[model samples]
Target chain A: MRDGKDDAAPRARRRFLKLAGLGTAASGAALLAGSGAAKAAAPAATEAAKGYRVTDHVRRVYDLARF
Target chain B: MIAPEDQGRAYLYRLLARLLAAAPDAATLGLLRGLGGDGSPVGGDLQGLAGAAATAGPGALEREYHDLFIGVGRGELVPFGSWYLAGFLHEKPLAHLRRDLGTLGLGRTAGTKEPEDHVASLCEAMALLIEGKGDLGAQKAFFERHLEGWAPAFFADLERARAARFYAAVGRLGARLMTLERDGFAFVEGVAA
Candidate 1:
């Protein structure tokens, strides 16, 4: 049951996403290739293991939002 | 294994998180200017962003960002999930999100006063989930609990906000992506059911 549902569900979801332009050159991969934005936020698990540290990008956001 | 298509989703989420986190610097703007998209709605919004980035100047962009997100007291739009869902900052929604994040082995970086439910943080969290830190079930649960309720409305508001220029494009793209994710998840659920 798990294997069957996983196969059908992911395929259907992937098809839907593709139709909606996700992961396509128009929407995802090509557009993000040169941008450093993708690396701006460290994953929570990684950050947790390494100790809590916000990147400069995230720090800047905090600074901007400070009242 | 993470699929290439899922990588795109992570990339989109990270880009949105970055943009919402702060105004774009010169390098970011340059990247945005070079972005190309196909004819889909999401693609059209990307094109719109590229156009906006091409024409935007640093000074004006700074002012626009400030006006839209971080004015003297508060900006025109509050980008926190708590505010959107609970009519205030640091409300129950934030507490719930914090509890959820802890369960996922995630926590806010020390010394950051912003709540976990800030739009940027939520987007970043979603990116992490998609990037393989969390399973599909986790991603679905996170989106449904924290973002699905209010993020679409926030993005729609950002698109039409008076001070939005480049960010209007960001907003449009965000709105479209959220819709796609919501529908995509539903499709999966329907199949599973």
Candidate 2:
């Protein structure tokens, strides 16, 4: 029962995001690049680390938060 | 096939995770001070955060963070999902989340004392999901299960917490993002249905 609505959902979501001031070039660049403080939470290393994985990003966040 | 909007979303989550994880260092604060926003509600919150960042120092922020999240006994607010959802820490909700995380190939990092349900950890998990570790369906499910039940209330509480100053802005931004995320996920479900 896929319809035009299905095709339109993502586009509509994007428009809603744009109207909310997200997806802008400047803001996105500032957040993604300029705010280099927080590293991207990648699943690669965590997945490979141990059968039990702790995400490096999460670990680093903890390390930084430590007083 | 991650979209630009999604990247922005992931970064926002990452930013929140970082701030909630700990007070920002001077370098992070400088970066925050340079941020700009538009007329949208999220934009306004970003502006508020920028203003707070501009005025705040690391030592003060660290103290404020401690008062708000890590007091001598317990902070003004406990930022754990289990605490919010079950009225205690290390409850069934956490157990459920741990099972889900295992399914997703994620786990608590060794040596970390905080439960996996801590707000920062959850935000980081969401960021990872958005970055491609999980698809839209998975993201929606995880968010609804873990965050939707109580995160908004937690943010509202954080905004009003006595120790909140810089974090008040964070609370506002978090509350706003949670609303947007809920709506966004609903949009996906509406289309899928």
TM-score of each: 0.84, 0.83
DockQ of prediction 1: 0.28
Note the DockQ of each predicted structure: 0.28, 0.19
TM-score of chain A of 2: 0.33
- TM-score of chain B taken alone, every candidate: 0.95, 0.95
Off by over 4 Å in 2: A1-6, A25-67, B190-193
**Which structure among the candidates has the greatest TM-score?**
1
Question: Least accurate stretch of 10 residues (summed lDDT) in model 1 chain B?
Answer: B184-193
lDDT tens digits, residue span B1-193, model 1: 6665677777778778767776787877888888887886667788898899999987888788888877765578877888789876657888889998898877866665556776877887888887666877778878889999999999999999999989999999899889888887875442221
Q: Residue B124, candidate 1: how far off, in angstroms?
A: 0.3
User: What stretches of model 1 exceed 4 Å from their correct place?
Assistant: A1-6, A26-67, B190-193
True contacts kept of each: 0.31, 0.17
Compared with the true structure, the alpha-carbon lDDT of candidate 1 equals 0.73
Clashing pairs in 2: none
